[model samples]
Target: MAKKPDWSKEEQAVQAVQLAFDLSNDIQRAFRVSAALQDMSTADMVRKVLQLPYRRARARPRLTVTLKDEDFELLAQKYRLDPQDRAAIRHRVAEELQGFARNYLTDSGH
Candidate 1:
């Protein structure tokens, strides 16, 4: 003799109803058409719909800086650098200042 499996039919019915309600319009229509012709659980229909993955855009690296508001505004006005050349300009300026200070201090000998 084969034993019958115990099934929670009431919980399954509630889950089916909930999944049907949550389905998109196109999927819901497909589900309804499938349901009318055959015995299909809403969970199965939803699983079919869920085969399409949610696409997320790739993340890009970003730079952020923090400064005193007044100092930031003053620096912005003083430099007025082109966005593209700003890093290069800063590098050149720092190199030149270091060289000048080194020469001046060495020559002074005090």
Candidate 2:
């Protein structure tokens, strides 16, 4: 048997609903540039323009990138690791990013 809904009626009433849509490439780029120039996230800028309530910020900030299967394979090859060992590849990628920051910081005397 399928499991029942986890949310209570009152809880569901207050749940946030996502609004997502696609835009043409030119329009999308313009929107992104506008947001960046104003130092606002695209989502936050959109909310302000639409007169919607702001989102609650996460307690911890995190960076994210979406990688395709081919991208993963490339990373594995670059790092000389098994493609199946995704965790190790991710660790290596993180190390590379940290090294990049460290190098820039040292070079710029920051």
Candidate 3:
């Protein structure tokens, strides 16, 4: 019988290291705008611009953002949803975004 090889060390070796960049506000906003226009996450856009290989796209596409109390209040007013009901507020926001994309994003989905 042969002894099994350890896999924990190999797992750590293959793990990706996260990196951070301290860019100016204007540059950050520009990157974000470019990514949004291309329907990509900012990280993916940056990697593509640098010609770096990146992981494949997820099975299900999604957009994520952190909404604070003030954000919720504003969204509630604009969406006429109950601010206390976060789920409803989030669903409405998603619906609104879908509407915006359906209306504005070109047929190419860009």
Q: List the residue pairs that clash in candidate 1.
A: none
Q: Which candidate do you rate higher for lDDT, 1 or 2?
A: 2
Candidate closer to the true structure by TM-score (higher is better), 1 or 3: 3
Model 1 spans > 4 angstroms off: 1-83
lDDT of 1 by residue, 1-110 (tens): 98975669886676653422565799778776664344444444445557733223213322235545464455545666543455554555566567886997799675
- Number of the top candidate by lDDT? 3
Please give the ranking of all candidate structures by TM-score, highest first, separated by commas. Answer: 3, 2, 1
Is candidate 1 or 3 superior in lDDT? 3
For residue 66, give model 2's deviation from the true position in Å. 3.8
Candidate achieving higher TM-score, 1 or 2: 2
**Model 3 CA lDDT for position 90:** 89
- Model 2 TM-score relative to the real fold: 0.51
Local error of candidate 3 at residue 63 (angstroms) = 1.4
lDDT of 3 by residue, 1-85 (tens): 9998777976877886888999999999999898777777788878988999754453356878998899999999988878898
Show the lowest summed lDDT stretch of 10 residues, model 1. Answer: 54-63
**Which predicted model would earn the best TM-score?**
3
Ten contiguous residues with the weakest lDDT in model 2: 54-63
lDDT tens per residue, model 2, 32-99: 77766666667776886788875445334455899899989999999999998999999999999989
